[model samples]
Target: MSRLYGDPIEVWTREGEPIQFVWRDRLYAVRRIIDHWVVAREWWKVDDDDPGERRFWRVEASPGQRLGTYELRFDTTGAGWLLVRAWEC
Candidate 1:
């Protein structure tokens, strides 16, 4: 099972990809990026003042011996990084 967080976080990236992130005061190093995708506003809602496109990265990360699967989001309209979801390993 996974948990939804939606908490703002600080992320460090390499070549535009997340390599490390800090969440809840602990730092996690991304071991691998499992998936990556982008979501855009619907064509019909283009003028609805949406937050623009959102990019998501599902990654395998670890802080010490505790490894977890995390979903991170980047809002193109400048909402910044968010730790959206997580699954414990």
Candidate 2:
């Protein structure tokens, strides 16, 4: 897996499920969502109580000709969307 820290992206969702995303100047259509979960705020690591949760989605996608699995995250604290990791399948 390759890590991408804070890589900005645009996602298209249908009924709260991510259908596709644009990242690194390419469009990737999600074929399947492998997992979905929420990361709760780490209260002990922060000074304040406003550490918002993060949503994560692991998906299998096709970017043009190649297929890959990627981990996407959304920060509720205004950090925006991020492409966390990706690997060829």
Identify the leading candidate in terms of lDDT. Answer: 1
Compared with the true structure, the alpha-carbon lDDT of candidate 2 equals 0.86
Worst ten-residue run, lDDT, model 2?
A: 42-51
**Model-by-model lDDT, in order?**
0.93, 0.86
User: Residues 55-87, candidate 1, lDDT per residue (tens digit)?
Assistant: 999999999898899999998778699999999
Sliding window of 10 residues with minimal summed lDDT for model 1: 42-51
Give the C-alpha miss distance for residue 27 in model 1, angstroms.
Answer: 0.5
**Tens digit of lDDT per residue, candidate 2, span 1-89?**
56566688999889977899999889999999999999977877554646787899999999877889899898878757888888876
Question: What are the clashing pairs of model 2?
Answer: none
lDDT of 1 at 68: 93
Best by TM-score: 1
